[model samples]
Target: MALRVDGDSPQNFSALFDLRGTADTGELRLTSPIGSTLGLARWSPAEAVLDNGSRTYRFDTAGELIRAATGADIPLDALFSWLAGQDKSVPGWRADLSQVDAGRINAWRDSPLPRAELRVIFDTP
Candidate 1:
């Protein structure tokens, strides 16, 4: 995922996500190319948490947790659906499903300022 802030608070980052678990509850671990852990995001029905080894933060929802961590509000539900080739729609975002058969997907958030993009490439079983 690539996050870019368009205004005065401009920021950018791209991380490879090691995502696991179900739609309702799961853990997402972000890491650098050299195997250094950047952070871990965990969510359950009760709450959501982000742990950066040295500090821990909590939020009311997974969306909030992700927003705090990435400077973007990404819809986790729609993200999972897109990965599964479900063509779920996320407001302010557009998903390209043309390459799902090749195990790849691309989604972009073009509005509400600070445009962002997400790409997923999965192993074909």
Candidate 2:
């Protein structure tokens, strides 16, 4: 999957996802050259889950998670930032993150470091 954010808006972002692989135990194990084996993502028609062992993230099909494991509401920017920081090999889209609501920003501030598992959502072209 490829994600592109245009302008300073998270809503302006575009995601392209290409899924391949078999489903096992309600999980879709995809192998993409852009991702790592440690990255395990599971998705169903209603929800998406990403588990990296220490942290588990659950998001709606719309790519919005009600709350992170830290009990914090991760803003769109911080979420992308945290994800970008994980694998440096990912493209340079990190520079596009924009300011979000203060309430959302505070959720991730001073929070415990996230586990290696990073869950992302993309629109299938």
Clash count, candidate 1: 0
Q: Model-by-model lDDT, in order?
A: 0.82, 0.36
TM-score of each: 0.88, 0.28
Top candidate by TM-score: 1
Q: Which residue ranges in model 2 land beyond 4 Å of their true spot?
A: 9-35, 52-54, 62-125
Per-residue lDDT, model 2, residue 13, is 16
| Number of the top-ranking candidate, with lDDT as the measure | 1
Q: Give the per-residue lDDT digits (tens) of candidate 2, residues 42-125.
A: 655677687755687778641343233223233433444433332222222222222232111111122232212223543312
* lDDT of prediction 2: 0.36
Clashes per candidate (backbone, < 3 Å): 0, 0
Instruction: Write model 1 residue lDDT over 82-117, tens digit each, in one string.
Output: 878899987899999899889888888888777777
Q: Which residue pairs show collisions in model 2?
A: none
